[model samples]
Target: MEMESDFYEAALFHIDRERKLYSSMPSRHYHNGYEIFYLVSGDTCYFVDDKAYQVVGGVLMIINMNEIHKLVNSSGETFERITLEFKSEFIEGIFPDNSSIDIFSSFTKGLPMIKLSGQEQGAIEKRFDTMIHEYTQQPPGYESYLKMLLFELLLFIYRKMESNPRPALNEANLVHKKIFEIVDYLNRHYDEQHTIGQISKNFYISPSYFCKTFRENTGFTFTEYLNNVRIKEARNLLTHGTDKISTIAESVGFESLTHFGRIFKEITGMSPLKYRQNYKV
Candidate 1:
């Protein structure tokens, strides 16, 4: 099924649990809402943004909105799983509102791709079973019950896998909040001009200081990080069979063909022609 925005607000959700029932083909695309999938049975290759996961029973995946990724099973096998989708605002509403907030952090940003341990998996699944019951049965007041159940399940996962029992508001951490803001903005608008001076200027900081701290925090210089984003977009378009390497380069915001070609070759260690040629095989 083609997943869409707000598949989570009262959520036009779906679950599948049968041989060849819920498996789908690979198409590298990004969504506009959060999604969680539990591989309840069988094993298959699950592709996320720029990586692959050997997903089997009890593994959970959180596919956040706007994260360029895809699902694939090159082995021509079937897998069983249930997928949950929700809106960002809905999840954000779960945060506490405090006026004294200072920093700029978001649970939505820098989310490390996650996997559940064997014990943790079983524990979360037990709660998921309850979620399935509430959702399927849809008894009286089931709406609130369903939301409440989902909330608890999420909290349970976070508690088990995350160091924090509950994530505080972004304002809780000043430096991280600022960095996250910059990263979020960059991700959303990397196709535009995003010099360190421009970003630092908007944030009311000196360019030199911003560059130094950003490198320290994210472990990459500003240019390197921007190219990383561009390259990821390029890979997505290429994997999805978009034609014209020149078009992909422009779409990803490189201003010049020569510069784009050089950067692509530098990072990927081959020309775009070579890159796309391999995918044709």
Candidate 2:
């Protein structure tokens, strides 16, 4: 659960580490790249963009770039996971030059988690192990083999997506979509100060109406939502790098380091420095 540093490309990755127990050494945060975690051991509860998913062995969780998320294993138990990270552009390198991006695009977007059967998980695990071996050894022309293995992995994911599709549509789902859209926008633009009035004007609603609806939908008032947003960003920076705490405070829309530290502790139950110490990659 520490801050792990990795540079991922378009290729597949194979991980088979064993954890003795469920340790919440690090809390929630975000990454700069896309990820696919194929759980090979115990169950883990994960938060991806604030939506929680209970993933067990034989389950696969897909995460997009810059997405906020984290993991916690409920039981006092150990587990293993195969985590693969890559860029979306890495897709063009896997697929043929003329192949359409349609199939691949969907994989990165909708319904980001899936649970696989025992047999299905075993098959993918075997291939992933073989792919990892070849990638690490790098025999002559191994790139060709590596690329082929990655293509097979993609094909498997696409087929699984086809088998168990998400529900069609509902009014509740529409409101959920709207809420997530606004949240995503705020996450991307938290540096600029914006009031309920501004957001309501943009969303074509009255200020009071917008505040009430947003709070009802997201379970947090506008100011609370904004504070949490900044706190999440601040934690990411503190644990991920050596930037000055003050600089991170301002980067996350906090006007002062003291306020950032106070709120961070209120949410994370620890100060920024302590959080950083627990997550040195």
Candidate 3:
């Protein structure tokens, strides 16, 4: 079962309960607003930027805007989750002017995953239930009520994090640890030229095994992952810098302008020039 609500483009809420295993993970992507993901049951692997987390039931993952992430099932168990996404404007004026707190700071600082205790999880579940009810029923002032509920939820999490910080989740296997290290390396050096064989040699693993493990853990082949990292950086440059398209292409590790244009369009659904025109500030 799945339920979803979109509030005037500023916020979105979704709940999904799946009884069967997912044949494939969702495509890697990022959002324009902050994302709050609560795993209600089962287990999964969550990749956020450079690190991969072994997320289980009762874990909440916060992803900042434009941070690349993906979730893959870790086992054949059924799973359920609730996701809330909201732009900054969605909760504007909720905070007092003199307050020193930034409720959403968790999205930017510290570990992205939070492990909630049984009691804490119950509290959060109640807030989600209320938000869902208000959204579905559309009672008087339901929109405002929903916003308040979201604010309360975030504040509760923020306070919990402040009072008792949890350690980061460890990789479940040695192979996963090594693959995540490779992911970190790739994230930092995406603009440099690389080859699977070279990376495997540097990381002290057989090329074939590296390819298999990388794909299994990250849901992307070596080449695909490299291209994604490079393209992700390329997108940032296109949006924030005044570099020429060819320069941007080469800087992000594409050897050929034509190839860059082709891949850029393939991944982003538009030519680089068009993307720049639409998104450049």
- Residue lDDT tens for model 2, 228-253: 65665566588777888888888888
Residue 186 displacement (Å), model 3: 33
Please give, for residues 1-281, the per-residue lDDT of candidate 3 as tens digits: 53222223324554333334562336567767888888765556777765777555557888887787778764645556777778877778866682788888877775677766544655676688688788777899987887788888888878867875654343333337667667767765778889988998899999998887776654456786677657656876998999999999999899999999998876666789998997788
Scored by Cα lDDT, where does model 2 land?
0.63
lDDT of 1 by residue, 63-182 (tens): 666665555543344555677766635434444663243112222544423444434544565566677777788878776666666666666555544564332211112234455567
List TM-scores for all candidates, in order. 0.46, 0.50, 0.54
RMSD of each: 17.2, 17.1, 18.0
Report the C-alpha displacement of residue 58, candidate 2, in angstroms: 0.9
The RMSD (Cα, Å) of candidate 1 is 17.2
**What are the Cα lDDT values of the candidates?**
0.59, 0.63, 0.71
**Shift of residue 224 alpha carbon in model 1, Å:** 38
Prediction 1 global C-alpha lDDT: 0.59
Ranking of all predicted structures according to lDDT, beginning with the best and ending with the worst: 3, 2, 1
Location of the lowest summed lDDT over 10 successive residues in candidate 1 = 165-174
Clashing pairs for model 1 are 104-177, 105-177
